[model samples]
Target: MEQLLTVKKGNSRTTKIDVEGVYYRDLNAQLRELSSKGIQNVQLLNVYGQRYIGTNLSQPMEIEISGTPGNDLGFLMNGSKITVYGNAQDGCGNTMDDGNIVIHGHAGDILGMSARGGKIFVRDDVGYRAGIHMKEYQDKKPIIVIGGTTQDFVGEYMGGGILIILGLNLSEEKTYRAKFVGTGMHGGVIYLRGKVEQYQLGKEVGIAELEEKDYRVLHDNVNEFASYFNLEPNKILEHQFIKLFPRWLRPYGRLYTY
Candidate 1:
């Protein structure tokens, strides 16, 4: 039978669990050991707001979380797949290196901050700073997709990586009014599927009509997101997308001296 362990409430708010006797117990050490031993498909029960649920898994293992998970749910995850049935708190997939994190519900702030690789899909709305400080590396690019409206600073200081904000819940009129959407962004792409009037792009970046190449990338990302959340792919492609990129302003040049 599969292992199960209930954490004992202690003086500290954090709960600690130790596993034993079962295939996949809740013990911190054993879980890692089993994963290291090439075990796959671990099931977790009653996981209420637990932090670091499947962090840093060296091997490719599937973890199904039943309840809501706390902040940093998949901190620095290497090569594991985590599916959260409920909502997730702040920093849901902070600094993830590889693999995928699928949240059936909403997510909190800084969802994928500084993530180097991997993909994060949120079926619902998300809080502020969803993809702040995200950078891209050769052969390994990070991508974040939000189904509903996102809060301010959606793609702040993003050196690389692809960020797609689909305003499914809001009207087309007010979808692209996020504050500081691409401030200090130097690389990668930001595709917004709505009528964006504010146009608060950073001095280093410029906005233009998305070309066929850009739409192909956006379509791939959004299609994967739709499949993960069981949405209609064709409908998501109906809207137009605006592509944002760095404007190539020379730093420490005449602009700053003035």
Candidate 2:
């Protein structure tokens, strides 16, 4: 039997919850209740492995987490703002439709598995397949800006949207180590800072030279990432970056067509 979390009113519009041992189901239920009551600001402290923290939210609300959150931290979240003070597990933004998620620490594999809207900013490295299958929704393009490099398959099977990776923690050599990047990508773009060898890319991927428009996009998104982590956009944008695109619109269209 799980007990309901005792919601402490931080102020007239803010609520605080200490989710140390509470079940994820009860925690979310309380959150739904809070949202129903028009509570817009929530602070979760001592959180540990609480899955789906803001998945049910479909409106604009602000949530702050203190400890590590479990998988699918903001699954299908819409128009919510989640700020994690610590790390996050796999499927952080799986199928998320809208809103913002800011992580101060590292994230696990498949960071934004199938997100379609809003922005996610991380201050540290990420695991494999950070932006796998990320697409856009209407005029809203899902944006993922990683402060540090990710493992293999950073943008695997990405269909649409923007994926920005800044290798801020590479060794002095300044060479990327991830391989098979954009393995099954069909659409969208990948902006990676640092050097990646030709052999490191997948057969379906191609490198293209950046244009004036590309620089403007980088300038704006880098500033967004910098604002989150208190970094200087100029210092990061000064590094050499590469643009990776899919070689074909349908890399494997023939596989299932006939």
Candidate 3:
């Protein structure tokens, strides 16, 4: 285990770890150690299916991952940036507080469940419940943007945050297939660039016209999303978008109130 990871010698600010065949616990311990040492940048190579790759990372550092990571990639993270070169498994950013996660490929289920703050950008599709239960805490707000479509219940029970689905991979004539979107949602917003039928939405959701403030949010976030994947922000913003808002606060409160 000790020989598998090599620390880059003579570089005080930056270090590289060859995390090939190392256990997840050991890898994380090394990460915590390096972060405490004030390492500004860390690169992980050959990281195949390592779960909890960036858990409990509170420092403002950068991580470059070469291979696919396992579930809960950034669980409970704070104030860091992680860029994945390959696909990530389920629960990519589960319950993260503050940070940025950039995935170059697709991700599995529950992409950003219960995230309080941070931004997650996936260049490809994600599995079921992509942004479930994201909430705002005081001044913190979470944001998630997907370049492709997601599976069912994309934002189920959302409390607060911003979610954008560009559907850049889908044909213009096709509609997003995620059904029951925003089911049980009481807060937050979703912006979609492609088509979705009214019947596909949950009873609690309603499509609203995009206001000026909405456009500004789209322009800024889409610009950053575009910059990550080498896309044209103007071309993306040229397309018409639909805004989905929760019809009211606590959409299901009546069921429990009386």
TM-score of 1: 0.85
Candidate 3 to truth, TM: 0.94
Best by TM-score: 3
Give the whole-model CA lDDT for all candidates, comma-separated.
0.76, 0.88, 0.90
On residues 60-86, what C-alpha lDDT tens digit does candidate 2 reach at each position?
689999999899999999989999999
Alpha-carbon runs more than 4 Å astray in model 3? 1-12
Instruction: Indicate the TM-score of model 2.
Output: 0.93
Model 1: weakest 10-residue lDDT segment is 12-21
Looking at model 3, residue 124 earns an lDDT score of 96
Each model's Cα RMSD: 7.0, 2.8, 2.3
Summarize candidate 1's per-residue lDDT along 165-198 as a digit string, tens digits: 8888877355555777777777788888775554
Residue 131, candidate 2: alpha-carbon lDDT: 93
lDDT of 3 by residue, 1-258 (tens): 342443555664557778889899999888888788788688888998989987875466788899998899999888789999999899998998889999999999999999999999999999999899999977899999999999999999999999999999888567688999989888999999966899889899999879999999999999999999999999999998999999999676678844
Regarding lDDT, does 2 or 3 come out ahead?
3
Kindly give the number of clashing pairs for every candidate: 2, 0, 0
Q: What is the lDDT of residue 177 in candidate 1?
A: 56
lDDT, ranked from best to worst: 3, 2, 1
The parts of candidate 1 lying over 4 Å away from their true place are: 1-27, 172-177, 249-258
